[model samples]
Target: MAFHAHPDDEALATGGTLARLAAEGHRVVIVVATDGVVRDAPGAALRARLDELRASAAVLGASRVEHLGYADSGHGAELYPDPPGRTRFVRADPREATARLAEIIRAEQASILLSYDVNGGYRHRDHLRVHEVGRLAAQQTGVRLLEATLPRELTVRAYTALEWTGLVSGHNRQALQHGFTPRAEITHRLDVRGYARQKRDALAAHGSQLRKGRVAPLVRLLIRLPAPVFGLALGREYFIEPGAARTGKPSRQIIPPAGQG
Candidate 1:
């Protein structure tokens, strides 16, 4: 089960990995913590976004897609008020959220639970809350834990270059201050280059966000690239498992054998 903070996060972060696993006959599932509803997009727009999410999941070959039933926690210098009738993920009770997520983990009998790293990739409050809640859910369910993250050195170098190239905005660059996990700290670096098509298709399925400008410009550029170029850019996904020693090289896969943890 892969747990994400929002709709497109699964695709942007681990879509290729999920596609590969699903294609290998593994039952892949995606669980998101929020509706990705930061603003008051028309009700129809929100419904369409959900539909798009399901479409994306189908493209990735996921067996199930579940939402934890929370609202988005807006990001940026100015905090936006939560939409009426919904609680932002950052404001939700962590214990309650974890309990609900634990139920899903138990129900799925999932061996692995994917969440976000300590820094939540860019210190997004909702993503950080996801990290905390996901940890608790793993502890409660005894599922193996894997947190999604990028290699710190890679992120810094690549983004710095992108900034220099004028591809990244100052605001987005500033958000990277919290940092990603160093290469030595990453436990898995699954290569999903072969399933890039599935990843790309899944990413495109979230058309509303792509059209509405919900994702970062970098992501938009990636999705718009030719298939081969897109694969080359995001062929691998990185992860860290708490308490696990870093291997000399990244593991090709995340799941252990049926009898293993």
Candidate 2:
């Protein structure tokens, strides 16, 4: 099971692993925590993107796709500027969201649950909330949790690459001012090079979000890199597996549990 704050998130974060897992005959379901309709676009444009999400999910080979029906709290803006809104996920009760996620976990009998890291990777408020709710759901339901993270070394390399390529600008620097960490702490790497095409196809599905921009080309390049080169470049998909027995205090050595295969 994969839990994400929005539609494109799954493709960006775990499309490769999800595709690989489904190809290997494992049941992979995607639970989108929010509707992702809060982009800088018109209502019709958002609707089109929502449709694209479904198409992308099919291409990614998800066994099922479930939506928690929460509204996307536009990034960098409070969901409610005046009074609170019921649709805004960030404002929704945490326990309520967690229970909803727990129900999905129970229904699917998911042995492995994938979600974003504690920092929400780039600190999007909804993403962070999804991380919180996802953790609560996994804990309550006793499902194995996998937090998506970037290895520390790989993150540094990516940042370096962006800087060298002149892609990391003042805006990115300002965003990182909050703080950043090594991606390797999560510990599991899924090489998605083989599924890169599918991942790219999935990304392209989110047309509203993928407006003509510099980021699109960068994303395309990142996913299109050859598997070996990409692996050497990005290393692996970092993960933190919950409920695994530890020989020592929690460190970055965690691996997916045996049965998850």
Candidate 3:
């Protein structure tokens, strides 16, 4: 099971890895914490994003997808309050959120919980909440944990590429440089190049999310790239296991058995 902050986040962070695992016959599940509803947005938008999430999950070969019943914490210095009856994900109690996610982990008997690193891949509040909740949920359920993240240098390189296209300004680039894990901290670096098509298709399913953010252009550019180029740019996915050795090169697969995880 892969737990993320929002609908499209799974596609960006775990689409390739999930696709590869699903193709290999493992049952992959995508769990999101929020409905992607921002400030003053109509509540109906959540329904649309859920539909898109389902579409994206299908493209990645995921067997199931679910939301934890919360709304997005919009991107700004100040966080808005709950929308009607919905709780903003960032404002939701961590213990309650952890319990909710833990219930799913238990129900799924999830062997491994794929979560985000401590920095939540760019310091988004909702993403940080996801990391916090995911960690505690995994601990509560006794599931093996793998935190998804990019190497610091690769993250900077990606930001630089976006800066070149004017999608991410220097301020944004500097902020992103502080996210992701360092290379030495990485444990699993799966070569998902083979699943590029599935990954791209999954990413394309989040059209609504990809159409308006400052990083939208960067995402759109990725989707427009040729298959080979896309693979070269994002061929590998990285993760850090709680106690996995970082002695040699990172492991090629999530687990030793081809389909165990």
Best by TM-score: 3
Off by over 4 Å in 3: 256-261
lDDT of 1 by residue, 43-145 (tens): 7867777788899999999999998888888776565777777778888899989998999889989978989999898788888898899899988889999
Model 1 CA RMSD to the hidden true structure, in angstroms: 2.1
Pairs in clash, predicted candidate 2: 150-183, 150-184, 151-183, 151-184, 152-182, 152-183, 152-184, 186-239
Clashes of each: 0, 8, 0
| Evaluation by TM-score, superior candidate among 1 and 2 | 1
Instruction: Give stretches of model 2 more than 4 Å off.
Output: 39-43, 77-86, 164-168, 174-184, 212-214, 220-235, 243-261
Each prediction's RMSD to truth = 2.1, 4.0, 1.5
The TM-score, computed over Cα atoms with residue i paired to residue i, of candidate 3 is: 0.95
Q: Lowest lDDT 10-mer window, candidate 3?
A: 252-261
Model 3 pairs whose backbones collide: none
Question: Once model 3 is optimally superposed onto the true structure by TM-score, how far is the C-alpha of residue 166 displaced, in angstroms?
Answer: 1.3
Q: How close is candidate 1 to the true structure, as a TM-score?
A: 0.93
TM-score versus the correct structure, for each prediction: 0.93, 0.80, 0.95
The alpha-carbon lDDT assigned to residue 230 of candidate 1 equals 88
Q: Which ten residues in a row have the lowest lDDT in candidate 2?
A: 249-258
Whichever of 1 and 2 has more lDDT, that candidate is 1
Question: Which is the better candidate, 1 or 3, if ranked by TM-score?
Answer: 3
- Model 3 lDDT tens row, 155-261: 88877876676777888667677898888899999988888888887888888868787778778888998877898988889999877778888887886545353
